[model samples]
Target chain A: MADPAGAPCVEVVDLHKRFGALEVLRGVSFAVDRGSVVSIIGASGSGKSTLLRCINYLEQPTSGEVRIDGEPIGIERRADGSERRRSMREIGRFRRDLGMVFQQFNLWPHLTVLGNVVEAPIRVRGLPRRQAMELARACLERVQLSEKSSEYPARLSGGQQQRVAIARALAMQPKVMLFDEATSSLDPELTGEVLEVMRGLAVDGTTMIVVTHEMGFAREVSDRVIFLHGGLIEEEGPPAQVFGTPRSERCRQFLAKLLH
Target chain B: MGNWERLVWNQRNVLLDGFLVTLEICAIAFAVAVAAGLGLALLRLYVRPLRWPAIMWIEYCRATPIYVQLMWVNYVWPEILGWPTTFYTAGWVALALQSSGYLAETFRTGIENIGRGQREAAYAVGMSPLLTFRRIILPQVLVTIAPSIVTQFTVIVKSSTLVSVITVQDLMFQSQRLVNVWFEPIEILTATAAIYILFIFAVSAAGKALADRLRLRYGLGT
Candidate 1:
């Protein structure tokens, strides 16, 4: 049942992340509505990927809270007024609701494309093999990779491999899909195919949080765009507002370098 | 009867029995080596309390001679522990104990060869660590080390000869017995060496076939 209080599908509050002395994310926060696409754009080393990682609990925030469906992620707030990280089992179960597509398309190399897509449903969800295979076929079809279902990841082109990865994530039926520069590793010529699949998903109203440098995709497909600079959100608004008329000097200069 | 015909007629069955015993020792020792070796590798890599001890034991086994270890386990261990130790038991125990270190090193190397992203990908799919290890990591490890394990198996087969010193009546012991009885060291030794070569070559061939099949099935390489 939907909460009457109208909580967003994803809420990240005052997130901070540090690796040793290097503070990568400094108090960045955002909320994502149901079935909306948000893109985070920034220059290299601007902490956009870290922010996405924190949202998925792939990287633990130094101090902050993330909520999925108005429930705290990975942390149990006890009556003793101390917060403790949930057990690995709890985290794994919670993570099933969020699918992440990596830049390297980390498909299980030892399995066929269908096997990669069906792994979570079969292994974690305990779906029957017949049912899982059917679901996998549908997901592969969605990505236009039905022909490559029996093939291995290495046999596919970089674009095809990434599309299979997207299908693999889609098989989980996650509440939100997180793309950490999904197209970054593709050849310049091959990036468009992967982006096209992404655009199709966006049109179908898939909720997504993409950390990317694809400025055109952000400007065209995303409902909102967040511009990060030096571990902070320098600008955030509708894509037209943020991309057309960036507010911060840092964001403006970054955009100038990127657009030109 | 001709001399060679007489020798073959008298000694063929004895040599066959000895060859069977050698194979038995190798099979048992191989099983021991694989199980113990995998345990040692995992303990050294993951189990904190036993890590140092596993490392030290592996180093010790790799450092000392198997011949000496066999002698010690056969002769000294029983006295120290106040237990019975037989020739059969000693040969297997000593050979497995020594070779497990090598197998452990092989496992560690294969495990290192796997990319970190493999585990991360599994974890991202909401798999428990146990599931991740079983489904994601263990298969790759088995495929990676299949050839090395075959090489080790052949070595163990040859090392079965060491048991002859303790009167286990394996291939070497029986062959030496035939030499004493017949006084035909050159011919008998040549035949024995030929048997060993045949056995080792068969094992290597079978291992290669199995490895190739696995690689192709897993879509690893040509």
Candidate 2:
């Protein structure tokens, strides 16, 4: 379903976002090539989550562009130099191509694990109930939660619930998966299990953009790392280079504060 | 004891018939209240253009006393709207109007109490707003507000007695008729009061059980 053969899986150019008087993202730009993993690392309030959200149009950008597989989303520009915000129907269709995982898990508590995974595929994708259930089972198997598919989210442990959330996203078969601090809300011990599933996805060459506080996972698993500072990219490069010898003093200090 | 047997027991068939009418009116009123309440609450919360009108209607229904509304609907509405042209129709309409307002507020509170994250999660998966509300939002709201909904129904049952003023021939109407016939208010009215207390007690108890069962089955209950 990925039609653009050479176009980047996800791209953002000169993105800016403001919440009232607070500017959360300022002129952020980057691209993730197909089948590559890029991790975004930043301090709290540095706009890492906001940047990820804008990429999927969850947080609308005040200005600039986000394109998925070379097609612009959220806002469309016309020849007359005016912008039209895309209709909810249009945006909703575009969002089907991207999967997003939240820090809160956000699983529908009323639904069993299988129900949560199959709901969108059946409702949004218009997949047959049988096909959706089959897809849901496969996704649950990938997360190693097939046994828990019949259970409600509240009955699951934190790690287990997050895994179900991942499976829920995976069922979409999205072109690029976005993780917005996906493991941040878990217990320290539980974070590892969720991170392990993410690492497996990276190994399987799923195109991904992860916003994280987990430095070890980011450094070891990511092909590239972008460190955000006050709504701007302070430094970005291969994880090895950014972590080993950062260019900016802020990057150096941030890494030092985290690593030690 | 003789009066109890004569006025209360001997008049069992009349009282029973009136009780059935009470049940019928309450059932119709409660059904309308649920459906209309949900519609009004959604309009108030989601439809920007209709929000103020929905709010005014809900407030009007709530602020007026039930008896006054009953009288107004029974007397004035026919002149103004030329509908609900019978005593029975007016009785249920007035009852439903009153409860619909309270239930609308209940539904709004339930919908608002849901976490924003739930809707965002549904949207993130590509579900449209309507789909999200139907499949995700409404189910959770129903479970969370089930107890309050049951309470509202009891309130409706209790308030249904006032319909007798319009000659609706409900339980209260029959008991009053018997009082006029025997010219004895003590025996029959006491029996009527006791019957109402017991009937309401049973309805609420059953409703509570059903709500609890729903919560245990679908909610995050342990």
lDDT values of the candidates?
0.89, 0.92
Model 2 lDDT per residue over B1-222, tens place = 898999999999999999999999999999999999999999999999999999999999999999999999999999999988999999999999999999999999999998998998988888899999999999998888887888888898889999998999999999999999989999999999998899889988997897887777666422
Off by over 4 Å in 1: A1-5, A79-82, B1-5, B8-10, B81-84, B213-222
Segments of candidate 2 deviating more than 4 angstroms:
A77-83, B218-222
Native interface contacts kept by each candidate, as a fraction: 0.62, 0.65
lDDT of 1 by residue, A1-260 (tens): 36577899899899999999999999998999999999999999999989988887778899989998887887988899898889888888878888889998988888889999999999999999999999999999999999998887868999999999999889988888999999999999999999999999999999999999999999999999999988988899999998788778888888899867
Give the per-residue lDDT digits (tens) of candidate 2, residues A50-144.
99888888888999899988878987778999988899888999888889999999999899999999999999999999999999999999999
Model 1 chain A lowest lDDT segment of ten:
A1-10
- Per-model TM-score on C-alpha atoms: 0.94, 0.96
Per-residue lDDT tens digits for candidate 1, residues B13-47, read 98899999999998999999999998999999989
Instruction: State which docking tier applies to candidate 1.
Output: medium
Report the error of model 1 at residue A211, Å: 1.0
Clashing pairs in 1: none
Please give the distance, in angstroms, between residue A52's alpha carbon in candidate 2 and its true position after superposition.
Answer: 1.2
Give the number of the best model, judged by TM-score.
Answer: 2
